[model samples]
Target: MKKSLICALVIYCFSSVAAYAAENPSVKALLSEMSKASQQLNYQLSYIVINRNTIEPLRYSHAVENNVQLAHLVYLSGPMREIIRRGGEVSYIDSSSEPFTIRANYMVAPTIPLLNSNINELSKYYDFVLLGKAREAGATCQVLRVVSKDGMRYSYVLWVDEKTKLPLRADLVDRDGDILEQFRTISLAVGDGVSKALGELQNVQLPQVLSLPQGNLTHTYWKVSWVPNGFKPEELNRYKLSGTNQMVESQLYSDGLFDFSVYVSDRNDQSLKSQLVRQGRRSLQIYVSGKNEVAVIGDIPPETALRIARSVKFSPVAAKKVADSNAVNNSPETDVAPESSSQ
Candidate 1:
C-alpha cells in the first residue's frame, strides 16, 4: 500500500507541471504565430457568420503589396456590400450606411477575429489554453480557448490551421458556456496567386478618408466607478438627441479585444427601466440613478454590463459646470470661425 501511494503522488506532480506549461508560454506562442501568419501571408478566406437564426456568407482577401497591407471583404449573397482596405485607408460601401472612407489600419467589418489583435496585451487579462488538435475546414487544426481571468466577460474558442497557422473557426461563448456567434471558414486559399489577383486594387479609386472632429476631453459630471480589470476609458462625448434636443453624455471603454460604452442622460418618459438584454455578442444594461439613466452597452456579459451601469456616480454641480463649458465652446465665433492668433 505504501509503495502504490508513493507512485501516485509522483505522477500527480508531473501532471501538474505539464498542465502549467501547456497553458502558459506554449499557448501564447501558438497565438503569436497565428497573428504573424495572418499579417504576412497573402490569403483568401471564404466564411460564414452564424448568429442566432441568421447565417451570412462572406469572403475576405488579404494581401501585402509594397510593404503595405491591402484587404477586401464582400458579402456573398445579400445586397451588394464591400469593404476595401488600402494601407491606412478603409472604405465602406454598403446600402444602409453612406459610402465613406476612414483612416484605419484594420477594417472594422466582420472579418476574421484576432487577425491583428495584440496577443501580448490580451494575455495579461486572459488565459490561453491548448485543447489539442481538431479537423476544421478540411484541414487539421489546433484548438484553443481564450478564457477570461475574472469570468466576468465572454470567452472564445478558436481552431487554427496547423500547417498554415491561420484561424479556421472561432466561436464566441458567454459566461454560461452558450455560444452566441460563430465564424467558420468554408474554404481557404493561400499563395502569391491570391496576391496577384488583388493587385488590381492599386488603381481602384477610393473615396477620400474622412477627417473626424476631435472630441473635447473635458471632465464630466458622471463617472464610472468600476469596470473590468483591463478596461480603459476613452474620451467623453456630449451630444443632443435629434428630435428631443436632450443633452447626453457618453464615454467608451476598451480592453483591447472587447469594449463597452457608458451613457448618461436625464431620466424621462423615454428612459427605459432598469433591465438587461443580451443578443448575440452584445449586451446592454440600463440602470436608473436618482434623476439620470445609466446605460452600458457593448461586447461584454450581461452581468458585467449591469455592474458597470450600477457603479456610475453623478454630481449636480459638476453637471452645471460641464453645461457652461459646452455653451462657451458652442458659441458662434468658436463654431463658425477659424482660430486667430490675436483672439
Candidate 2:
C-alpha cells in the first residue's frame, strides 16, 4: 500500500511540473519579440481600424534611432488628424477641432510604446499567448492572444507578421465574444525603423504642439468619489460648439493601454438621462437640467462607463482648484500590482 502511494505521488508531482512548464513556454521570448517589432522595426503600413459602424484605413510609418521611436499617423479618409511623435514629445495637426496644438501623453492608446510601459507592464492585466501560424497582409502571421488577467478589463488578439513580428491586425473583444474594434495592416515593410522612413512623410507639415497653459480658468474639475483602478487624468480643456451656445469641458484619462475621455457640458435636452449609443460604443452622458453634464467615452463596456459616470459627484470647490483635485479611491497601490517576471 505504501509503495503504491509513493508511486502515485511521484507521478502527480512530475505531471504538475510538466504542465506548468508547458503553460509558460516562450512567453518571455514572444513578449520581447513583439516589443522589438513595435519599438525598433522600421515599417510603413497601411492598416484599418474598425468599429461596428465605422471603418477607417490609414497609413503608418515608423522609425527608431538611438532607442527613440519616431512615428507619423494621418487619417486617410476623414478630417486629417496628423500627428508626429519622437521619444515622449508629440505634435499634432488636426483640422477638425479648432486646429489647436496639444501634447499627447506617450502612454495613450492608438499610440505606440503605450505610456512608456512595455508589454511587461501591461501583462499584469493581460497574458500573451501564441496561436498557430496564419497568412495575412500578404505575409505569414503569428496570432497572439492577450487574454485579460482580470475581469475588470477587456482582451485583445493580435495577428503579427511572422518574419517581422509586426502586428498586422489587432482585435479588441469583450467578455461576450463581441469584437469592439479591429486594427489590421494591409501592407508592410520590415527593414528600417521610423526615422529612416521619415522621407516618406517629409512633405507633410505638422502643426505646432504646445503644452497646456497653467491656471486655465475655463477648465472645470469635478471631484469623483471613485474611479476604476489603473486610470489617470492626462489632460483638460474647455470648448463651446459652434451654432449653439453650449459649453463643454473635455478631460482625458489613461491607464497606460486604455484611455477614457469625460466631457462635461450643460444639461441641455437632458443629454445624460437618455442613453447615447453612437458608433456602436455605448456611453452614458449624465446631465441634470441646468447643471453640468458628463459624457464618458472609452474602450470600456457600457456598464463600466455608466458605473463611472454615475459614481461621479461634484465637490463644489473642484471647479476653482482644478489642478489640485485628486482622483478618489483609484490609487496605484489599490489598483496596480508590483511588476515582476511571472511568465
TM-score, one value per model: 0.88, 0.68
- As a whole number from 0 to 100, the lDDT of residue 20 in candidate 2 is 69
What would the per-residue lDDT of candidate 2 be over residues 186-302, giving only the tens digit for each residue? 777766444566744544565556666542332344544455666777645555566764656666666666667776665665354746553443454443423667677876667
- Cα lDDT of candidate 1 equals 0.85
Question: Could you tell me which 10 consecutive residues in candidate 1 have the lowest summed lDDT?
Answer: 334-343
Model 1 misplacement above 4 A: 1-25, 324-343
Instruction: Determine the backbone clash count of candidate 2.
Output: 9
Model 2 root mean square deviation, Cα atoms: 8.9
The CA lDDT of each predicted structure is: 0.85, 0.62
lDDT minimum window of 10 residues, candidate 2: 334-343
